[model samples]
Target: MKVLIADDHGIIRLGVSQIIKEIDPGSTIHEAEDFDETIRLLNAHIIDLLILDINIPGGNNFQMISTVKSKQPDIKVLVFSAFSEELYATRYFKAGADGYLQKDTSPVEVKSAVNTILSGKHYMSQNIREYFLQGMIRKEVNMNNPLAELSDRETEVARMLVMGISQTAIAEKLNLHTSTVGTHKYRIFEKLAVSNIAELIEKYRIYDYS
Candidate 1:
């Protein structure tokens, strides 16, 4: 089987590659540090599975999933990100990702996710499954956590805000205009009923939305 691991962190790629090798010793694996490299590798190889990171340079949105699929219609994509499952898993699933796994996930769960996707099935954590089921039953996202109400972009901005990243820095990192990042920050504060960064941080801590 052929697999590609796309992540900016070399350690993460190495660890994931090691796990894949342990699972299937003969599997052919490739690594890419960013989205462009990932696409180049995809075009050059017959990759069966793509383990992608959402925050990769040149691709940081839902569109990345489709972009990769457009290149290889039969390739399976597993979104590997630091964003919480509650915040981004469903969005990615709806965007054509075959699976979602957080950066902090255990090696065992990573192996399980890879195996599940390789077997031609979708993979989601039990927590995300319950959230999805509840959303289906209610016909809306679970708003018990106010953070869930933020749009994907807003959520990204909020994370950066809480991490002490400046609006200018966030704009640059996300490839958005400074004014756009400011708008997202305003919406995030309004939605979460916070007035400032401190309040936002406190609210995030209370919700444990990590």
Candidate 2:
């Protein structure tokens, strides 16, 4: 089997490569330190599986899944992220991930998830499964999700804020006035009912979904 490990951290790539080797001693493993490199490698190799990080450099969004699938429709993708499953796993699944595993997962479960996806099955934790069931039962928008209240632009600004980007920097990146970015930040905090970036991040982890 051929696998691509796409993450910015050298340590994480090394560790997961070791686990993949243990899972299949003859498996061919390739590593990418960023999303651009990942796409380049994908174009250069017939990868069977891609282990992806959500926050890899050059992209930190679900569209990355679409891009990957567009490049190689048959490749199975496993989202390996440090983000909370409740906030991100279902979204990744909806965006076309074969599986979602937290970075803190044990080596045994990592192997299990990888093997399961390799066999062409979806994988999710028991808790995520239960959450899906509960969501289906409710069958409604979660009104408590404050992040959902933000507009697309506001959400973009909020994410940058949570990432520690300055308002000026965000304005420059988004091509908006600094005052407009500050206004968006103020509105985001207000909508999320948070007083500061720390609170916004905490609320984000609790309520943010795709």
Extract clashing residue pairs from model 2: none
Off by over 4 Å in 1: 133-141, 164-177
Candidate 2: Cα lDDT at 84: 63
lDDT string for model 2 (122-142, tens) is: 999877778677774124334
Q: Per-residue lDDT tens digits of candidate 1, residues 1-210? A: 899999999999999999999999999999999888999999999999999988887677677888899999999999998877776788788889999999899999999999999899999987778866766512444546777787777877887799798989888877889999999988998899999999999988887444
Sliding window of 10 residues with minimal summed lDDT for model 1: 135-144
Worst 10 residues of 2 by lDDT: 136-145
How much is 12 displaced in model 1, in angstroms?
2.0
